[model samples]
Target: MAATVEAVIAALRVTLEEAQKSREASWKVEAVNRWIGQLPGSWSGRWRRLVLKSDASGNARRDELVAHVRAVIAFLETNRQQIAQSRKWWPLRRRWPANSPIANAPVAAPASSSARPVNLLRVRKPMPGIH
Candidate 1:
């Protein structure tokens, strides 16, 4: 009777462990499904390649990379219209502050300003009417 009871208890424990494991696996699959659904088509090929590579090593880093890429892609897609509109519009013009000395610096005068003008009105008398 004791042996039978122990066997039954062990069986129940095994079944419970199996159930928990299945639940965990189901959750993982669900998460994966959600990710795949939300991911953009452009990134699918790259992500699929990374997943295939990582599957052999069982490392989930590649999956994390895929998730990051998917998030960035989704963000860009959502904001694309806004970005386009912003590009079409000119950026706000910022007026220079009146108190900013750099903005009020004296501009250098052109070099021509320093040179004397030609004396066009000078009377050139030929030396003692020698002309």
Candidate 2:
């Protein structure tokens, strides 16, 4: 279960968006480090060595690091097609399911898979929470 191009891209995008939305340095660092751990093959090791954040006194410093990484992500977006078809990625691919269990979880079947439609909208309860 190696990491597909879609998984990598999605993970990177989600991490960036979440970190951008949060003002806390610790939150940003944790999000980024988690992403780095999920990176495919050597990428994980490489990013782990990089400086995401240190005992910084303020959020500004940590945010700047994440901002700089966004440029690299933008480049990745532009070259997505190329990266998807690259043979190099085959060996470097990571196990996507290992990092995202929710995505791979079994979808529960309907309790009444054979039954017809249940018109819940028409048979509404006498308004919930009413005495």
Candidate 3:
């Protein structure tokens, strides 16, 4: 039960971090607000009182702020992988690359430091003028 709880928390943290990065990188204010809006009141309230108050949107501290955010995201990702593996989620563990589809069984192991580039080319084109 503890493992499950931790896994759920890790998953949510990853989701929130990705949402935040998408918003910051793309100027998606509505998306950012929506992500916050979906959170439980207590979580957001606590974060606002703690991190947000300390993290005034001042340009002089921009680098420090961004670094802190990135650190949090890194921590989240690490724990998420740990919790998933502890639960024997093969798709998350025993895989050469973290995001690759799980093989039927462990075949060949790849170095953890090796980075694989993801190809994002999709087959279908968007309906005209959608973006």
Candidate 4:
């Protein structure tokens, strides 16, 4: 019975590791998808069909995950080069200026009462005639 319990624990550990890897892979795929979607019109669709088609299988094997990530990186690099070469693609790189009012707005401070500073070292005076 002890051997069986140990074996079960080991199996659960393996299962947990696999689940974590699967989740990490899924997150990577989603991130790549988001970047691809940000590309100019029809480019995202074309790239998705060409580069990320294999990811539709829903398999999270490590090799498959690496392949998907590599494909996405390659696609992004190529697209970036193309965008740099084309004058019409400048809009893709244009971001709102950092100095904008919304971006410069100060964060709100935490709410607190406006109280006088406490003096921890102050001695209390003895009450008159109370001795």
Candidate 5:
């Protein structure tokens, strides 16, 4: 009877250890899921690549996952100002059509009398057949 009790206790200890490991793994997966979900749209592709690399690494430590999230957050924060400025100016700096009047015209004088006139003519390229 004592031997049976000892065996049962040993089995219970193994079961508890396995349960704890399962719980920890579940928590880590949930944390990674939350981090991925919260990642910015612009950063999703990078995050996906990180996840693939991490999976290939086979070292799914919680700290490593958190480190990746923090790194991405830091990168986005550091570049946020530049990214915003570029987005703000991108549309305004669009390429002008070659045939537009503004493209063909010389610079006009500003309306204010004190403003100096500027020359800004487009240089024409010689035709291939005529050259």
Candidate 6:
């Protein structure tokens, strides 16, 4: 009976542990990124199979686009640490660079929150809109 009670207590304590909170935060960010990453794959598949025209009023389209841009900027700021700045968004466990000295060895967690996740996008015509 005592052993059982102790086991239950330990299980309950796991949620309150620092490691658990860190893992939860890390997982939340990773899961979100994984979902975002899937869009390109699915979009390309759909794009190849569909021939569709999109049209909308300048104001309506402008409003929608502006809203999306704001949301994206907020999300990026909030999740900057969780993102793999180099596009490496490796499973946080596999976040290390292969050529790095420690990369050959297994890393239990990331090096540091400040070290990763910078969202950079490039386009041939950039400056007018890069910001």
Clashes of each: 0, 1, 0, 0, 0, 3
Clashing pairs in 2: 3-94
Per-residue lDDT tens digits of candidate 3, residues 51-125?
322323322233444454455445435655553444332234454666556644568886577676656785566
The per-residue C-alpha lDDT of model 5 at residue 10 equals 46
For candidate 1, write residues 30-124 as lDDT tens digits: 22333333323313642333121223434334344345435534544565455334421222454567678877899998676767786877957
Find the candidate with the highest lDDT and give its number: 2
TM-score of each: 0.25, 0.43, 0.25, 0.32, 0.31, 0.24
Answer with 2 or 3, whichever has the higher lDDT: 2
Root-mean-square deviation (CA) per prediction: 25.1, 13.7, 18.7, 18.8, 20.0, 22.8
Q: List the residue pairs that clash in candidate 3.
A: none
Give the candidates in order of lDDT, highest first.
2, 4, 5, 3, 1, 6
lDDT of 1: 0.41
Question: Per-residue lDDT for 37-121 in model 5, tens only?
Answer: 3433323543344231335434455445445545544554565555444432124564688888878888978577777666557
What is the RMSD of candidate 3? 18.7
**Per-residue accuracy of model 6 over 5-115 as CA lDDT, tens digit each:** 233234324422433334222222222222233322323442122111124421223233333334443543454454423232223465567788876776588556757
Better of 5 and 6 by lDDT: 5
Cα misplacement distance, residue 66 of candidate 3 (Å): 1.1
* Superposed Cα deviation of residue 35, candidate 1 (Å): 20
Clashes of 4: 0
lDDT of each: 0.41, 0.57, 0.42, 0.48, 0.45, 0.36
Candidate 1 regions exceeding 4 Å error are 1-60, 88-106, 110-131
lDDT of 4: 0.48
- Please give the TM-score that candidate 4 achieves against the real structure: 0.32
In model 2, the runs with Cα more than 4 Å from the true position are 1-3, 26-30, 36-39, 44-60, 89-131
